[model samples]
Target: MIHGCRAIKRADCFHSKGHRNPCRSSSNPYMILFGAVEIAFSQIPDFDQIWWLSIVAAAMSFTYATIGLSLGIAQTVANGGFRGSLTGVSVAAGVSPAQKVWRSLQAFGDISFAYSYAYILIEIQDTIRAPPPSEAAVMKRATMVSVATTTFFYMMCGCLGYAAFGAAAPDNLLTGFGFYEPFWLLDVANAAIVVHLVGAYQVFVQPLFAFVEARAAARWPGSRFLAREVRVGPFALSVFRLTWRTAFVCLTTVAAMLLPFFGDVVGLLGAISFWPLTVYFPVEMYIKQHGVRRWSTRWVCLQTLSAACFLVSVAGAVGSTAGVVGAVKLHRPFSGY
Candidate 1:
């Protein structure tokens, strides 16, 4: 969202001023504004209730992605041919061989992060009613469709963006200021991103909210702070939920302010969470649930897949951590990157 806001601002500035003016700005204010919006949304009870928000989020996701893809295609056409090399960013004067290797590994983290929706698959599956078709079947179809569509857009946008900008491509395709002429369109794309992220933030954190609140209620079953609700106008509001969720949002907001390097943070998070949440746990659970014979062909294949993903996760973590360290050394906390 901070990036989105920055992009919008940059677009506006570049439109008014010349492109060479270097219209820099701070992301802290936008970060705070986003936090404030999230605090309000956090009050909503859980996943089942925010179906509309999820729908809107999905739509906004498509809106911005389409805009970005279109822009990339246009830029590539203007260039008259594809630009980037298959090996990726070249070994320039400032870029060392080790740095290039780390960046290549970091790209794995980015790809893993892009497909990390598996973390919430079961939560989504739980929302379906018992069916003429079983919940498993519904989820299987849904997973396949969602993953395929997402992968398609990811590949199109990534490949096109690379073709357009080559080694100079920005970490964020839209916010990277690649297309400066279409100012209003850029603004719309960034605005859509902000909207998309607003809902996405809540979607991702709701599980954590539920987990913490559930544990609190279990630990102190009789406490009013944990269990009591007060009427706020026509709505029933839980005191504990409000307080705890607010604190959690504030803490995370502060962390974001401290570490404002979006690319590195995202890569690091994807590296850290991808394997355990998306691969190992799910694969292990499937093997256990289905009673697959140990060391059988099926089991071996699954184990091999898990092992490969684990290695990717490790390499990604190392590269992303290096990126973060390098960023921190170059810039101070709470300062604009």
Candidate 2:
């Protein structure tokens, strides 16, 4: 959300002051605004209620992605060919050999972040209604389709973005001033990102809200504060949910304000969650649910895959942590890069 705001502000600034002007924007206001918006949306009863939001988010995602891909293609064509080398950003480009290695490892975390959504798969699956086909079958097919589509877009955006800008590519293609001439289009892309994130924030945090509320309701079954909901126009407002979700949003907002290195934070989270949430637990659950025999070929293969993913995740964590450390050294708290 902060990055989206920055991009929007940059677009406006660049439009008024020309692209060559060094336009700097702070992320504090946007972060607070995002938190406020989320706090209001958090009141929506549960995961099932946010179906429209998820759809809008998906559309916004594709909107920005398509715009970015088109822009990259245009830039590449203008350049007359691909600009990057297979060797990637060279040491001669002022990057040290060790920095190169850390970045390479960090790329794993970014990719992991891109593909990792298993944490919310169960929540999403729960929202699916029963039909002629089983929910499991529907979810399986949906997952496959989503993965294939995501992979295609990732490849296209990544390759084309690299081909266009080479080593000079911005950390964020849309916000990084990679394409400056199409100011209105950039604004639309950034707006789409903000809108997507607005919906996505609720989607991701709904599961967390559910878990906490469920546990609290179980512990204090008789407590009105935890279980009771009051009528408010068309919505039944829960005091407990309101307070808890609002506090969570505020806390996270403050955290974002303090550490605004979006890419580094994303990498760290991806690294931390990819192995356990996405790979290890899912693999174990599948084996347990299906009663796969220990040391059997299928079991061995799954275990091997989990082990390999764990190593990759660890490397990503280390690299991402290093990136965070370097960023912190260069930036003060609440300072937007």
Regions of model 1 farther than 4 Å from truth: none
TM-score of each: 0.97, 0.97
Model 1: lDDT of residue 58: 88
Candidate 2: list runs displaced more than 4 Å: none
Kindly give the stretch of ten consecutive residues in candidate 1 with the minimal lDDT sum: 87-96
Candidate 2 lDDT, 1-337, residue by residue in tens: 6788889888889989998899987788888899999989999879999999999999999999999999999999999999989999989898999999999889888988987799899999888888768889998999999999989988899989999999998887898888886889999999999999999898899999999999998898899777677888987889898888989999999899899888888998899899999999999999999999999999999999999999999999988999999989988887655
| Best prediction by lDDT | 2
Of candidate 2, the 10-residue stretch with the lowest lDDT total is 224-233
Tens-place lDDT digits, model 1, residues 1-337: 8999999999999999989989999888998998999999999998778788988888999998999999999999999999989988888836789999988888888888887777788778878999879999999998899899999998999999999999888787889887887899989889999999999988888888888888887898889677778899999989888888999999999899899988888888999999999999999999999999999999999999999999999999899998989888987788865
